[model samples]
Target: MYVEGLLSSLTRVKKARSLRAASWDTTGRNNDAWNIEPNETRVLADIKGPGCINHIWMTQRDGYRNVLLRAFWDDEEHPSVLCPLGDFFGLGNEIVNSYDSLLFSASTAGNNQFNTGCALNCYVQMPFNKSARIELVNEGDEMHRQYFYIDYELYEQPLDDEVAYFHTQFRRENPCDGWGHEIRVNTPEANIVNAERLAWDNNYLILEAEGRGHYIGCNLSITNFQGTWWGEGDDMIWVDGYKWPPDLHGTGSEDYLNQAWGMQPNAFRHNGSSIYEPDTDGYQTSYVFHLENPVRFEKEIRATIEHGHGNHLRNETSSVAYWYQLEPHKPFGILPVQQRKPVLRGEDGGWLINETAQTQQAEPTLNDEMKQLKAQWAEKQKTEA
Candidate 1:
C-alpha cells in the first residue's frame, strides 16, 4: 500500500528552512517567540522557489482575529493567501478548541490544558517554481507574541509548471443583504432573471478566481440573531463560464458538507461541525476538506450561496476559502477588521490571559505512534538484557 517515490532514491538533497523568533541571539533559551508590535508587518517566510512547503506550525497569544496572515507565491505583488491567522488554519471563531483533520488541526499543548494558547499545524503542500513570500500582520491595539516554523523541501526534481499555487481568502457579511417580510426593490425585475428566483443577486460569495485549479474546501462560521434556521440556504458554485444557477448546486448548508438534519458539535476526521456557541440563538462552525474530492475548474470559478431560501433570511456569516491555482493568480481583498469580526449571539467571548496546566485535572495522553514506539523500545531493552 505504501510504495516509495523517485525522491526516495535520490542520493543527495538540500533543505532550507527558518524558525523565526524575536530573540534569535538567545540560542533557544530565554526568548523564542517574536513579540509583534501593533501595525507591524513581520515577514515569516521569504524562500527561493524550486521548493514546496510541506508543513507549517505556529503558536500565538491573544488577539487571534487581530493577527492577519498572508502569503504570496511566485514572487507575486499581491498575496495569494490572506485571512486571520486563526481562521486560516480552521480556527474560525478565533477561540481554540482541539480538533483534528487531515490537512489542518490545532491542539492545547498541555494535554488538553490551556497552558499553550494553541499549537497549530497545517499540512497543505504549497509548491512554487519561482519564489514564496509569507507575512504576519498585527493589527490589534496591542502587541502579541507569535512563534512559527516553516518546514519545506528543496526538491531534487524541478517543480512542474502545472503545479498550482495555494491560496486562501476571507469574507464576512453581517446580516447579509436580504429581503425580509418587507421588500424594497421591485419584485418583477428581481424575478425576471428566471421567472422565479431564490436570490435576486445578493448571494454570499466565498471565492471568485480565474485560473486552472481545484478547490480545497472552506471553513464556515455563522451566528444567527433570528429564530430561523441559518442553514436554509444552499451552496452554489459557478465554474468556468457558467452564469446564474451555478454548475454545482447544493441542497442545504448542512447537506452541502454532508451533514444532515441540523448541525451538531463534533470533530470528525474529514468533515463535521465543531463549535456551537455560548448561545443557542444561532452560533455554529463547520468545516469540510475536499481532500479526496476537490472541485476542479479550468478557466474561472465563482463560489457562493444564499443567506436563506431566496436571500430572505438575515444572519452573520464568515468564511475562509482554500484553493490552488496557476501563477499570477487574481488578487483578492481582505475586509477591514471592523467588518471582519463576527456578530456573536450575546456578549463577546473573552479568553483567560494566564492559563496553567493546573486547571486541567486529567492527565494528557500520548498519541498512538508515540505509544507504539515506547512499547517497541521497552521490548528491545528486554531482549538486549
Candidate 2:
C-alpha cells in the first residue's frame, strides 16, 4: 500500500549492517550456479543472528514442485518454513506464470513455461535472535542448477523479545473427499437444502498450528476436475479454541481471495489471483496476504475451507500457509516427495483425471428423514432427465 514513497525510509539513519550469502564462483569465474544432484541437499544460507533476512532471490533451471525449501530459526530441530519451492515462491502445481506480489514473486522468460527457468524472490522479514538456516533439497530425479542470494541486515542489538519467527507449511488434498460429484454446482438439486456442517473434521485444512502466532495468509491452488465452476466453498478459520463457529468465516472461495463473481488474472500487493484458467481445464492460483490485519492467535489456529458448498465437490487442491509464531511450533510434517510431485497435466493443459486417486471424504451422519430426502432428490433427477 505504500505506493509512492516506499524508499523514504532509505534516508533514515540505518542502524543495521547489510549482508548477504550468495552462490558466487569461488574461482572468480562466471560459473556461479551450483548443480545439485538428485537427493542432494544444499545449504543456501546458514548465518548467525540478531539479524533479519530482508530479501531472498533464487533461480534454477527446473526447480519444480519436487524441490523442498526449508528454513530453521535459532537452530531448531524442526524447520519453521517447509514448502515446495514453487509454492513457496507463489505459483503452485509446478505451473509457473510469473507475476509480482508484495511478499513473493516469480519472474519468467515470458514463454509461460509450466515449470522451467524462473527467478523467484521472497521479501518477508525474517528476524532471528540466535541463528537461521535455509536449505534446499532436490527431491526430483534430475540435477538442478541453482543460483541464489539471501540478503540480511545484521543488528548490533538483539531482536525484540516479542518478535515472532516466520513459518510456512504446505498441504494438499488431491481429489479432496467431496460428495455429490454427480451433482453440478448451482443446480437446484445441488443446493444445501437440508445440509448442515456440524463440524469441520472433513474440511481441507490449509494450516493447523498450536502456538502463539498470527496468520498472515496463504496461497491456494486448485485444478478443477468436475468440469464446471470449482469455487463454491467457504473459508473457515478458527483461532484459539472456537469449534462450530470459527473466528473468521468467509462467504465463498472467490470472496476469500478478494474477488467477486469469479477469479480473475490479477496480481496486487496484498491480494489477487495469480493464475485463472476458468474452464473444464480449470487451473487457478490465488493468494491473500493479511499484511494489514493478521489473524492473531494466543493458543492455536486452524484454517480450512470446503471443497464445494457443504464439501460436495471433488477436485485437486493444495496450499501453503504463511505466518509468524513463537518457537517450539507444532510439527506439521510434509507429504513424501512422491506425493508432493505435481499431478500430470493432460494434452489439453488440464489435470489428467486419476480414477484411482484416494479420497478423504467424511460423509456426515444423516438421519432417516435426510437420507429419504436425498433418495427422493436422486429419483426426481432421474425422472426429470
Candidate 3:
C-alpha cells in the first residue's frame, strides 16, 4: 500500500519535465502550474535533490483569496510527522493558515536586498541523501543589503513512535553596514534561549544556542548595517515538537514576568530603539532542525518575504519553503529541564511543592488507571487458577 501511494504521488506531477532544469521563468507565476486540488487530492513531484520524492499539496479557498502549500516526504504515511514548507502558524489543532501572498521575482544587479515594492526569486531544492543549499541575492535597495540565513535539520527515533524532533539554526549576514537584525520564531509555543555570537568561519557568521520543544522559537535581525560588506553571520537553534510557556501564550502577547522568554542581549534595535518586533515584511529566512541521538532525521526550511521592507509594520508577500526527513517509530515526550523559575505557593498541607519534589511526582489519573487495571488483571488470574 505504501509503495502504491508513493508511486501514485510521483506520477501525479504533470509538469515534471519542465522542472528538470533550473529555470527562473518556470517559478512563482502562471508558469508554475502545479496544483494539488480538485480530483487530484495529492500532488507529488520529483525534483533534483537528495530525497527520493517531494509531495506538494495545494489548497485554495474563499474564492481563491487564500492558497496553501503543504510539502512533506513522499515516503511517509503520516505526512504531519514532517515539518511543512509554508506559513504554518496557528493553534496546534487548527489547519495552519497560508501566507497572504507568495510570488517569485528576479534581479541581475548582484546582491538582491529586500526593499519596499521589491519582488523576490525563490524556490525549493530537495536532494536525495544530501543537504540542500539555497542562493539569494539582494537587488532592490542597496541600503537593505543585509541577508539572514536559517537552516533546519529534522530527525526521529525508533523506540517511541509518537513525535518527531527538530534541531534548527539561524545565520545573519550584513553586506552593507553594521545593522541590527531581529530573529522571530512565528509559532507561539516555542522555548528559545542561549543566544550568543561565536567565532566566524568560512565566510559564515556563526551564532550558537540551544532550544528544545515545539513552542521554543528564536530570531536574529540586523540593526545598523555599517561598512561590513558580506562577511559571516551568527547562528541559533530550534528544537521542534516540544511546547513551552511562551508558545502557549500565542502571538504578540507580552509577559513582563517572563522577560527571559523574549529576545536575549536585548541591546540592539532596528531604528536605535530597544524593542523587538516580529518581521511581517516579505524577506527571506531559512530554518533547519535535526533530531539527533536515539533517532536521526533532518528537516530543512526556507522562509522568504516576497514583497516589501521592514518599516516596523506588517506586510504581505511572505512565504515559507521547506523540506523534511521522515523516519518512523521515533520516541518523543522526553521533557527538557526547565530553565525558568517555577511558580511557588505557601504550603498549607494537601501537596507540598518544591522543585525536586514536584519533579518526582508521577502523572495523575493515567498512571492511577494503569495501576488499577494491573491489579484487576492479577486478581482475575488468581481466581481462574
lDDT of 3 by residue, 8-93 (tens): 85565442222222222344664332333322222233232332222222221111102222233324332322211112211011
* Number of the top-ranking candidate, with TM-score as the measure: 2
lDDT of 1: 0.69
Error of 2 at 251 (Å): 0.5
Runs of candidate 3 with Cα error greater than 4 angstroms are 1-44, 47-67, 80-125, 129-326, 329-385
CA shift at 24, candidate 2, in angstroms?
Answer: 1.7
Using alpha carbons, what is the TM-score of model 2?
0.91
Top-scoring candidate (lDDT): 2
For model 1, where is the 10-residue window of minimal lDDT? 352-361
TM-scores of the candidates in the order shown = 0.77, 0.91, 0.24
Look at candidate 1 and tell me the lDDT of residue 152: 77
Collision count for each candidate, in order: 1, 0, 78
Decoy 1 TM-score against native: 0.77
